[model samples]
Target: MSAQPPTPPHMTVDEFLVWASERPGRHELINGEVVSQSAERAAHWKVKLAVHVALLNAVRAGGLNCHVVPDGATVRIDDATAYEPNALVYCGEEAAPSALTVDNPVIIVEVLSPSTGRMDRARKLADYFRLPSLAHYLIVDSNEPLVIHHRRQEGCDILTRIIREGATLLDPPGLEVVVAEIYGAS
Candidate 1:
């Protein structure tokens, strides 16, 4: 008897969630495949911390009922795709009680790393913009004080801004965070 080739493993979104929950480390579901994420560098962590703190502070200062979450909090893109953003904010009823994952995120931030920069800029960018509640997608550079802010406008056009310094107003949530504050230089 001739041996046949092994069948490629495929998992549904529900299966991936159940399987990933029992495993260690970080993993992302893309196109029905589980992909392990690499360990983040020091620079990446620093920038992520700054962004997380800034968002939390903004929510507190503004007295908004928004919740700021760091990495490990999954944001479901669809049935077969989920991502753990560097930072995210969920306001009002979108904030889950158990805090498992967020379905409606107002802002999602990603600190770009060399390994994931390409995917983050292209694939992730396209995927994240699909979230109807998403108002801003901030891609921060860990090596420099640069922030690529993508804000959805009146229509479908996204207003892109590259901020090295200064501040940008987040309209829907009505919070103003300076570029320096996000980089931990302020």
Candidate 2:
């Protein structure tokens, strides 16, 4: 008898979720491949935590029906196209493809990195704009104390990052953030 070739492994979101649920790490699905996403570096993680806490406080104070998403939560564009944005804010629960395939998120943030900078600025920007609910995209530099926010407008061209607070961080419309609060600590 002739031996057959090895069978390729395949898993659905549900299956992957079950298997990954037992593990103590973050991961994502991109183009049918289960790619393991890495944790942020110590400095980056510190900044991320600080920003998340600030945003959470602001979001809560506003009494808005929104939730701050943790990093590594998958956002599916299509069956084959998915991305785990660094941070995302959704007005209502966007957690179900059982109900909705696309999430109309208002904001998407990606902490800039050396490797992902070009991809985030170019490819990800175009991909993210496909969402009508997307009002702002914040590209934050990990090495520098800067944030470049791209906000959409009704008639005129979208507002680019005009808020250069130097060490002061500024949060514009749709979201409220204290400049000094985030950057002042470290």
Which one is best on lDDT? 1
Highest TM-score: give the candidate number.
Answer: 1
lDDT of 1 by residue, 54-75 (tens): 8888888888988888998888
Instruction: State TM-scores per candidate.
Output: 0.91, 0.71
Worst 10 residues of 2 by lDDT: 164-173
Question: Which stretches of candidate 2 lie above 4 Å from their native place?
Answer: 1-25, 28-35, 93-102, 155-157, 166-173
Report each candidate's C-alpha RMSD, comma-separated, in the order given.
Answer: 4.6, 5.8
lDDT (Cα, tens digit) per residue for candidate 2, span 1-186: 666333226556554555455566765554555666565686677656666776777778777777777575656654544567777777775465343223676777787776667877987777677667778777777665677778777853567774445332223334576644555544
Each prediction's whole-model lDDT (CA): 0.85, 0.63
Error (Å) of candidate 1 at residue 20 is 1.2
lDDT score, residue 76, model 2? 62
lDDT of 1 at 179: 82
